[model samples]
Target: MLNLLSGLIGLVTLILMIPAVLPLLGALNWILVPIALFGAFIGLMSSKKSGQYFCLIVAGFGALRLFLGGGIV
Candidate 1:
């Protein structure tokens, strides 16, 4: 399902946010947060209840990271 895929992306993004993990993933840590946020946004915009619920959790974490980090600062 599209929702499921998006949620998975959120999970992976969380993993990638860690500096130690990002190198293992061979990705730039700076780029992953917004990708996760975009996935969460897509999930949130879905009409399905499951999508909304899962996305809320992922998005909450993503928002917290953004808040604590310099994403908005």
Candidate 2:
């Protein structure tokens, strides 16, 4: 249940992240980072770690993107 919800959130965040990868759209990652973190928190409630790791990785990527862009591109 919690894992499923977390996976869904990760999926949605990934979808949103796709567009945010573009040069000028990097600012979108600011919003995505928190969303992915929320997903990770939900995943933490589940018995399994897969969902939590997935969300964490997604959040990491988003944070990395933001860092590379110097917060905004």
Instruction: Name the top TM-score candidate.
Output: 2
Q: Candidate 1, which segments miss by more than 4 Å at Cα?
A: 20-29, 49-73
- Return the TM-score for each candidate structure: 0.50, 0.96
lDDT at position 43, candidate 2:
97
For 1-73, candidate 1 gives per-residue lDDT tens digits of 7687777777776665565232233234446656766776777666654654554565566555555554532
lDDT (Cα) of model 2: 0.95
- For model 2, residues 1-73, the per-residue Cα lDDT tens digits are 9999999999899999999999999999999999999999999999987888999999999999999999998
- lDDT, candidate 2, residue 59? 98
TM-score of 1: 0.50
Q: After superposition, how far is residue 58 of candidate 1 from its true place, in Å?
A: 5.3
Candidate 1 overall lDDT versus native: 0.58
